[model samples]
Target chain A: MQQFKTLKDLPEQDYFTGGSSACAGCGPSMGLKLALKVLGPETIIVNASGCMTLLPLYPNTPLKASWIHNAIENASSTAAGARHGLDMLGNKDMNVVVYAGDGATYDIGLASLSAVAAKNERIIYICYNNQSFGNTGFQWSTATPYGSETKTTPRGKNNPTGTTAVNKDMVKIMGAHRVYAATASLAYPVDFLNKLSRAKERDGFSYIELLGACTAGWNYDPRLTIRISKLAVRCGMWPMYEIENGILTLNKDFSELKPIDEFLKLQGRYRALPQDGVDRLQVLINEHWAELKEYNGQRYV
Target chain B: MKQTLVTGNEAAAWGARLVRPNYIPTFPITPQTECIETLARWSADGELPGTYFDRMESEHSVMSAAVGAAAVGARVFTASSSQGLLLMHEVLYIAAGMRLPIVMATISRGLSAPVTLWSDHNDFLDQRDSGWLMFHAENNQEVLDMMLQAYRIAEDPRVLLPAMVNMDGYVLSFTDEPITIPSPEMVEEFLPEYNPDHTIAKGRPVTVGPPVLDEYTIFRAQNHVAARNALEVMEEVMDDFDRIFDRRYHLVDEFMLDDAELVLVTQGSMSTTAKAAIMEMREEEGIKVGLLRLRVIRPWPAKAIAEALKGAKAVAVIDRNLAPGRGGIMFPEIVETLYHLDRRPLVSSFVVGLGGNPQTEHKVKEITRKLIDDLETGRPRVEWNDL
Candidate 1:
């Protein structure tokens, strides 16, 4: 992971074109842009059907590199084939990357991701966690945080807890396979770029989950996409960490974490969460952070 | 050439081994599991050199991986059956629309609600309009031969579409039959190395499966044109194959149909029984009954089918799979093919061999006798060969 003193030190090449159909202040777009910046032009992107599928609609596409849009749940498997195919063609230098969404990654595509990791396929898989199915008008997905208001988990007059289920820990699941798994955010471009670069340099299966903020889905102002993401990590809602070769390293260490309400109140989805719900969520976050801390700079026994 | 007694599944594996595909992404499914097992064993024994083999989690992943490999300029192969084929249904259209030229072997079997693992065309017929060139093999020999020809047809520049070579589930998949295995040099001359014009490489960038709005119709129309062009391309490939290997193939094979008044149209393994019935009807019964076996169903082979059944008084389509209320699936297709003829033959449907029941020679002869009677009676448009 290389560090740049300034933003201008980054490469000038743009693999992701400007005219994308993504919404304004799209966090996933920024993550994709930065990831591609590190990956450069010698890469083939296997994108699952999601918001990214809409980027290249019809004859027009915003991808400057060779890209394929596969079914929602098979991006990892598709990229595995692409890597093997490229290897068979004697073009081992080309990188095969899977750009997928949370619904495709944490839910329907988890089996494929697990299989790819088990097989140790040489490819980079990036999951843009937008909390819900943003492409289909914000249905409740497994990655959606507890108590988040979604189409399927609407906050009704009778039911106060919008979504009772907690968000799936995909990073830890990938860690179980002992593959290089990391968590990054668009809010921290430099850190995100560093992790993305390191993931690109790895040989076998590598996974990175990027915290992507959705303006319409979360009912947040389009201008605060990066601010909301930063608040998420600052309040201990989303941790910044990496697990490489069974060794876990916490990228952002905070002695005193901010309250969860400061992050929850910023989004409309969590507005109806009761005081008790917030307290319980805070306790869960604290316990999760403590568990993650044990792995900081430690190897799995 | 070496002759070996092997099942259809083993023949399919031999065909793939001879082709030396760069990648094989497959999952095990009943009747088709042996094919993948053979491939895995070959890969372990170092017999499959330079091939990347993976047992995918599901049929969907299998097809997806094959698509990815094909898109990256690799010759790919995969196999599925029954539920497995249905699982891969969605990716089938993508494979053809992208024109990746991946080859798959499907062991025809009945779909499950009752969980029957038997020979039937329900699984194969369900994917009729999936934009893939489909070929049905009558025996293990054709299974081995068609597997080799499928690549040549699919990779043809004029017809860059995915192809499926289908053999009946247990009848061919498990039944042992004598087949000639071609040498590596012979197969090399038959199917030259797959050199794709376009791929997802670093320097060559292309957007595969991009959304198509107003131009969707044109792309679909072009696919139809390409699919139709496969008929000619297949004919040329088969001619070349015959010239090299001395084995002839036809889109629709005819047996004793030159002076017959009744023809029993069949597909898959049932065609062998139909041929035997034709022999018995001609020699012992003194009935001029013939057999018409459909080899390629995708480009429809309407011209060849209609031409073969032109002089016949009536045609009895012995479909091993039923289409529920619509009678035998192939019956209507054959009737539709001969609709514009000046004197169209009367076509009757007979459904048999559902759920792997044997289509015995006696049953086929009964269907032939019914066809002979129907030439004058014109009664019972559809009948089922009762178990």
Candidate 2:
């Protein structure tokens, strides 16, 4: 993997072109730009129906490499097919990647993702986790954190906490299939790029969950996309970790973690949550962090 | 060519093997499972070299993978039936809209309510407007022959569309019949290696199946034009096939339609029983009856149907599947086909043999008798044959 000391040290050329259909301060778009920089133009991307699909509308595309936009829930399987087709065409070294969204990866597309991982298909599956269904007017998704207000889970006068469901543990699910699984955040470009480069070097069924922030869905300031992403990891809401070949490794070990309230107060989705609700969310995050530390054979903080 | 006794499922499997597709993404479903198992076995035993066999998670994924492979310039094949076909219904439109020439074999079976494992046209008829070219086979031979021809018709530049060859589930999928398997060299001569112009590769960076909002209408119109062009392409391929194998197939096979007063329009294996019924009606009862079997359901043979039934006194459409409130599935299609005729014959829809119920010759003769009776009064336009 190529080591980059700073943003200036990265490749000058961009595979993800400019003037995309994404809105201002789109974290997923930034993640895609970085990903294309690492994977290069020799890759064929299979994009499931989501915000990423909306980026390259017909007659206009922002990709310099080959891309296939398919139905909502078949990115992983379609990438598997592209892998097989490339092999049949005697181009075994060409990379096939699936760039999808949180709703597609964690909910609708999980079956296909699991199936491909079971076959150990040589494809990198990346889920741009924006917490909610960002493309469809901010509906609650399986990756949406508890107490977040979405179109489907609007905080009413009687129920001020919005959604009561916790976020699904997708990295652990992929890890259970014995594939290489990792979590990265757009706020940390170096770490994200490093993880992507490492994932590209792996042989089969590599998965990365990129913490993508949605300024429109979360009702945050457009300029605070990277700030909120950083707060998410700093507050232990989104931990950066990797599970390679059944061994867990935490990438970022904060000396003093920020309070979860600092992350929750930044987004309008969690504005209706009471003090107790924030405390409950912090407890859940602490429990998950302790479980990860246990998996790493370290004493719980 | 060598003669082998096999079921329709086996015949379809043999046809796929002869075509030697580069990729096959399939899932197991009843009656269609035999086809997948046979292909898997052949692939495992080294009989099908250079082929990538993908046992997909579901029928939806099966078609999704097939679309992926086909879009990347690979000749792909898959099979399903009934519920599985319904599961793949959404991607069916994707395959056609993307202009991927993926050939699929569907063993036609009844849809569930009270769940049946028998044969019906409901499964195939439900996908009528999905923009896929549909071919209905009567016997094991036609199953084998059409499976090979479908790939050529779909991959034709003028008609780049996905196609499905449908055979009755129990009637043909389980029944054994002697079929002449074509040689590999002959099949290779018929269908050369697939080379797609619009494919996703290293040198060519194409965005396949992109969202086209403003120009979506033009894309849809192009798909319809391609589907209509398939009629000519299908005939041309059948002509070449006839010249090579000495077996001819028409869009609509007519039997004793000349100087006939009554005609029966049918499809699938029921056409054989209708043919037998017409013979008996002509011999014993002196009724001037004939049979018109629809070989291709999509890009319907509207002109040939109008010509065949132009001077008839009445036409009876035997629908093995019902469309609920709308009566028979093909009745309205045939009625619309002959709507422009000056002296149109009386058309009646007869719903029979639904949910895999047997369609015997005796029941078919009863349907013809009902059509003859309707010619006098013309009271009911549609009737249940044995209900």
Candidate 3:
């Protein structure tokens, strides 16, 4: 993979438009723009039904690359078909990439995506993880982190915590499939682009889940999207990491990780988090961080 | 053409192989498994060059992948049966709404609740409203012929729609019959290479199957127009198919319709048994009963159905499927078509086979005798014959 020195190293030819109907400071829109920079126009974007489905709302689209939206839960399999379709047409240089949502990736589309990873089809799957079903007014999804409030997981008299279940360790699941799996953040464009470049270099399946911080769902200031993303990594919440061919690599490592309070307080979903909830979240993050450090630069799965 | 003994599954696979599709996405289900197994073996042996045989996890993914491949302008073929066909029902509309010309072989089986692995028309007719061109075959020869014709009719510029060529399960799928497999050279001359203009391609960026509000009506109307276009396109396709292959097929199959007072309307392989009964009734019983087998079901073939039944005194619409409260699924469709005719014959509905309860010559004779009774009484009856 060719490493870019800085953000300016991105090519001038962009395939994605700057803005559309998406909320201001949408992390997924940024992730898409950056990913398109690496993928270019010789690619087909297989989109699932989500917020991104509106990107091509009848008679209008912002993409210079070809796109197909099959359904909500079959983006991975659709990409598999597109990949084989191109290969059969004797156009192997083109890329097949998927842009799905957290609800699509972590829940409804899991089986479809797992089949692709198992087959090791030549495709790239990008899951824009906003932690909930943000398209449907912030409903709880399997990707929703613990202690976070969503429409379906509202805290009431009987329930002290909004969501009690932990987020899925998706990167580990893909790593076990022995393919290229990674976690990226909107705050780290260089890291995400670098991972995408590496994924393009491989001739098999790749899963890259980006931390798509939602302004409306998370109830944060539009201007603080990048800051919140940065804090997520600094607080050991969203780690900048990649697992390739069973080898784990931690991209951003902090000697003294910041406290989780700074990251939680910025978003309204975590505003009502109790002291005990914060303590439990911290313990979980610390344990995961310790495990990553131990397995760094080694076979992790 | 080479005359060989093969099952309906093998015939469908041979059709796919002769067409040389760019991709085939498949999953295994009983009665349809052998079709994909043949493709898989050929793919492993490197017989299918420039083609990718993909094995997907489920029928839904199989069809999803077919849509993805076809959206990129690659020819695709797949097969499924019963519950698998039900699972693929959602994407079938998407394939047609997007106007992707994909072809699939549907081996019909009864729907599950008791889970019978036998042939019935419920699985095939359930997709009647799905905006796909539908065809049913009576023998292994027609199975292969219809598949080749399906691609021609589906991929025409005037009709960029998907098609499903159906044959009865167990009876046709597993049983062997002599079919002439057309040569690849003849198939090439008959069906041209699929060069679709409405798809995703390099330097031609497009968004397929996007969301729309009120504009949804216009797109759906286009799907309807295109499927209706298949009615005309298929006439030309059948002509070309006959000119090259020396075999003929019409929108509706007519057997002994001339100078007949009683007619039986049927579909799939049961038409063969009904035809045998008609000959016996003509020779001994002095009954002028004929048969009308529905070969082309969608773009409904109403005019031909009316033309064939125009002279009959009473018509019996023998359905191999039961729609619960509704008598026979095709009963209303046939009745509605003939309602406008000047001499509208008395139409009776008979729901016969449910889960491969055999449709025999005696059952066909009984159905004809009942139609004679309806003709005498001037009243139509809806009865379950096989019960």
Candidate 4:
């Protein structure tokens, strides 16, 4: 994985196109490009209706591989078909990748996805979690952080709890399936690409949840997207790790973790928070990081 | 080539074997399960190299695996029956809509709920509009023949759509019949190895599916029309098969429908029984009741069907499966296919023998009498038999 320093270091074939409907500096699109670079072109990508769906257009779908435009709730099943078809054809040297939005993968397509993982179908499924349904206007998604305001979740003084529930732990949910499951950050392209490469080589179901920075939905400056993306991993807000057959392998351990404010203050979605509000978020982040550290340290023994 | 007595299910499995598919994903469903198991055995024996045999959790996953593999440019095969086919409903459309040539064999069985595993066309008939090319076989030989033809037509660059080759469960799948096994060399000549030029290329980059606006969506959807090109390609393949292997399949087969006052429409195994009954009636009382077997269901072939029953006074469609409140499933489709003809013949539908109930030749003979009697008396009410 380290041998490939950049997308340019790999094959000249760029699977994800440069221009599309995705917002400028959208982290998900960049992550998608890097992900495809690792999987290569002998791949069939199944995409649910999302920003990615609209980003790639005719004559120039940001993909250099076979692709299917699946319904929001059926991307997992659609990719399952691609996996099944590939195996039946005696073509063992290719990969099937399914990409979906948080709203699609977590809220709606979860059952279908669970079915695939339970069967352990040979394929790679990626969920680009922007924390909201950005495709059909910014709406609340299961992955939406505890304190966030969207068209659906309007900010009101009385509604102290910005969201009703805690963030859905997709990595943990997928990890429980006993297949390869990992969390990647758009801020860390190399690590994201490395996990994806390993996922491609491994048989059975492998999943990656990418915390992609949504420039439009998050209401952040286009140029600050990468910086904000990087801040997520730096603040220990988004831990980078992998779980292989129930064995947790922490990819990166942030020793001098920055204050959570560095990541949350930058995004307009969370800009309404005051100093005390920010402190509460920091405490929650610390609690999650400690839990992950304990989980990663313990082995089957 | 060595000749063997095999059922339609075995023939389909053997035909699949010749292609040397890489992956065989399937579930254990009646009638179709034998075909999947046969492939599983071949895959396990290493008779075919570099193949992956998957015991899919469900029929949906079976088709899902096929779509995924086909996208990555794998030649794939699978078989399913009534309930399994219905379960795989959504993925079926995705496979065809994506323009992947995934060839599948379906042994038709009645859909469940008072479950019985017997021969019925209701399973495949329900999915007549999923954009996959549909073909029915009246016997074991056609099963083998259509399987080969399906690969040729489906893989054609002009018609990159999935296709289903259907034969009746128990009736054709279990009944032993002498089949003419074409020499592998002849089959190779008739149907070449599937080589898809427009596939996922590692060296170059191209997007296969991207979002399109309204008009472009329709434009992209016109691939369904492009698939219509296979109608002629199917005919040409049949012509070539006749030239080399001495077997010809009419897109729609007709039996004595000409010069007959009453015509009976049926599919799959029932067509075979209807043919026997027509022959028996011709021998006994010389009653002129003929049979029209619909071989191609999708792309309906409306004009061909109308032309086949042009001079007939009445057409009785024996639907072995019900559409619930709507009599027989095929009956309505057959009637709809010829509704535009000026002075169209009286079309009648009968919903009978559901849930795999055996439709004996006596039932067809009884149907012939009812249809003939109704044609003479001009009965206003359509017959709905619950046999």
The numbered model that scores best in TM-score is 3
Q: What is the C-alpha RMSD of each candidate to the true structure, in Å?
A: 1.4, 1.7, 1.1, 4.0
Among all windows of 10 consecutive residues in model 2 chain B, the one with the lowest summed lDDT is: B378-387
lDDT of 1 by residue, A1-301 (tens): 5655567767888888867999998988888888888888888889998888888887777777888887898998888888888898798989898999999999999898899998888899899999998899999889998888999999888878888899988898898898999999887888888777777777888998999899989998899998999998998899999888788899999998999998989899998898887888898899889988877899842
lDDT of 2 at A294: 74
Clashing pairs in 2: none
What TM-score would you report for chain A in candidate 4?
0.93
Every candidate's DockQ is 0.78, 0.75, 0.81, 0.42
lDDT of 3 by residue, A1-301 (tens): 7788788887777888843678889888888888999999988999989888888777777888888999898988888888998889877899899999999998988998999999999999999999999899999999898899999999888877899999999889989998999999988888888889989999899999999999999999999999999999999999888998899999998897899999999999988888998899999899999999989999999
Q: What is the lDDT of residue A272 in candidate 2?
A: 80
lDDT of model 2, residue B111: 93
Every model's TM-score: 0.98, 0.98, 0.99, 0.86
Per-residue accuracy of model 2 over B9-112 as CA lDDT, tens digit each: 99999989999888999899888999999999999999999899998899999999998888788899889999999999999999999999999999998999
Fnat: each model in turn:
0.72, 0.64, 0.73, 0.59
RMSD of 3: 1.1
**iRMS values for every prediction:** 1.0, 0.9, 0.8, 3.4
- Residue B13 error, candidate 1, Å: 1.0
Q: What is the lDDT, from 0 to 100, of the residue B67 in candidate 2?
A: 84
- lDDT of candidate 4 over A168-215, digit per residue (tens): 888888988988898988767777877887887777899999988898
Cα displacement (Å) at residue A226, model 3: 0.6
Error of 4 at A79 (Å): 5.7
DockQ for candidate 1: 0.78
Clash-forming residue pairs, model 1: A58-B211
